[model samples]
Target: MASSALQVFGFTLGVLAWVGMIGTCASPEWRKNSHGQTLIDNTLKYEGLWVSCTAFVTGQTNCKDYAEFFVNLPQVLQICRALMISSIGTGFVAIIITVLGMKCVGLGSSNHIVKARIALLGGLLFGISGVLTGAAVSYYAQGVLQDYYNPSFAQGLTNVP
Candidate 1:
């Protein structure tokens, strides 16, 4: 079960890498236009999250560091979660921006932006679903990390009681 979970998380991490690369690979010329600019910005934003994730999974750094800085307070953790969630949103924005940019180029007539929109929307949906599922698996892995630093605390009520 745990292996399966880790696989899911790893898969998520891979998708994030792909998104980051796509965003990076997008043309700089696209940035000249406002619409294209938005897509590039959003894509890079998601890229940042994936970069962070890569660092964490590699044991170089982890979100827990940020979470700890906030003392894991709801207020601070909220910010952390927001960052993670926004990564998903950023991916969607990239897709939308890319599709819109494509449409602006006159990719097709009649169908026009419809197909572009649909393609981007579909990609976003798939990306988001992957991120959501990955988050669940990653959350479980957190226990192993917590145990390493403070075994007693993670063991159960003994840490608090």
Candidate 2:
């Protein structure tokens, strides 16, 4: 009974993780920059895998989707996009497999050993998805940091005098 309860808990957590991953991937505020109240204006900027947006203090926001051509995007953006998409895909597969393997689910073979192996494989896929997500976020953050510290980069509104 205790093992069944644990399995349920684990399955719940896995589903929540998958949902969180989707939210993170879809959010437009992955990276944010705020310009202090300058004489000209105060604005907030956000950049994400799919779009860039600006918010004005007057409660107005404007967003623009990325170019249709993937090749035109920066290398870091390209790699991160691929990794995040792959992670989502893997997580989806993991969810299906986990449901089949769960102790409470009767969709698959009744053999205990086979079910255990399937559960293990599902767990492994979840781990792989997590690793992919981490790599993508870390790589993107590294690129952002490198550009932020480089005086010569001269990109983004943050560099405005």
Candidate 3:
């Protein structure tokens, strides 16, 4: 009984994580620029993998999508985008595998050991998806920080929102 309960809980959490990954990939505000802005400026700049946006104090927002060509983007952005997309795909596959292997679903083999191994494989895929997400976010953040702190870099041009 306890094992069944644990499996349900794990499945719930895994599904939640997969949904969160999808949301993250679709969100357009991964990084924001609000430093040293006065009320007069009244503009907030933010960007994500696919779009850049500016929010005005007047409650207006304008966004622009990235270049159409994949090869035209910067190396860091290209890598981050690839990683996030891959993470989402992997998470989706993991969810399907996990559901099939779940005790309550029992879609295939009835043997406990086989089902357990399948579940384990799904869990590993989830782990890999998480790692990909982390790597992408961390790498992008590192680039943002480097640009933010660089003396030679133009502050006004950092966030293209």
Candidate 4:
């Protein structure tokens, strides 16, 4: 009874994590202006994996997709993009495997041991997905920090907290 309960719990958590991965991928607030209340309070600048934008309190906003100038992009930005996408893909596969292996679903092997192994495999994939996400976010954060602190890099601008 306990084993089945654990499997259900793991599957639920994995699904939630997968959804979160997708949300993060779609979010445009990966980075934003450090000071929202600047002298030019009308404009707010922010950036994400795919695009960057500036917004005005008056409901005006302008955005631009990341340029295809891959060579000029920061290594951290490049790596983060790759890793974030990978995490989403891996998480998706894990979710499908987990669903098939679920005892209630009975879509795969009937043997308890086989089902358990499949669940374990899904769990492992979930773990890898989480690790990749952490690495990507951390690497990007490090770059933001370095740039923020270095006057020569950002001038008066700093990364959003």
TM-scores, one per candidate: 0.28, 0.90, 0.89, 0.86
Model 4 lDDT tens row, 22-55: 8887788888765546568547888887778888
Q: By how many angstroms RMSD does model 4 differ from the true structure?
A: 3.1
Residue 145 lDDT in model 3?
Answer: 85
Q: Which candidate do you rate higher for TM-score, 3 or 4? A: 3
Taking the tens digit of each residue's C-alpha lDDT, what string does model 3 give over 28-109? 8788876466884568888888898889888899999986546878788789889999999999999889877777785978
Number of colliding residue pairs in each model:
0, 0, 0, 0
* TM-score order of candidates, top first: 2, 3, 4, 1
Residues 1-161 of candidate 1 have per-residue lDDT tens digits of 12335534543554575476345333122111112344333222111212222122223533212224334343423443454455556555644444443433344333644654544554565566456535633552353344446856435544210
Which residue pairs collide in model 4, if any? none
Using lDDT as the yardstick, the better of models 1 and 2 is: 2
- On a 0 to 1 TM-score scale, where does candidate 1 land against the true structure? 0.28
Show where candidate 4 strays beyond 4 Å.
36-38, 69-72, 156-161
- Lowest lDDT sum, 10 consecutive residues, model 2, at 152-161
- The C-alpha local distance difference test score for the whole of candidate 3 amounts to 0.83
Candidate 2: stretches off by over 4 Å: 154-161
- Candidate 1 vs candidate 4: the lDDT winner is 4
For each candidate, the alpha-carbon lDDT, in order, equals 0.41, 0.82, 0.83, 0.81
Give the clashing residue pairs of candidate 3, or none.
none
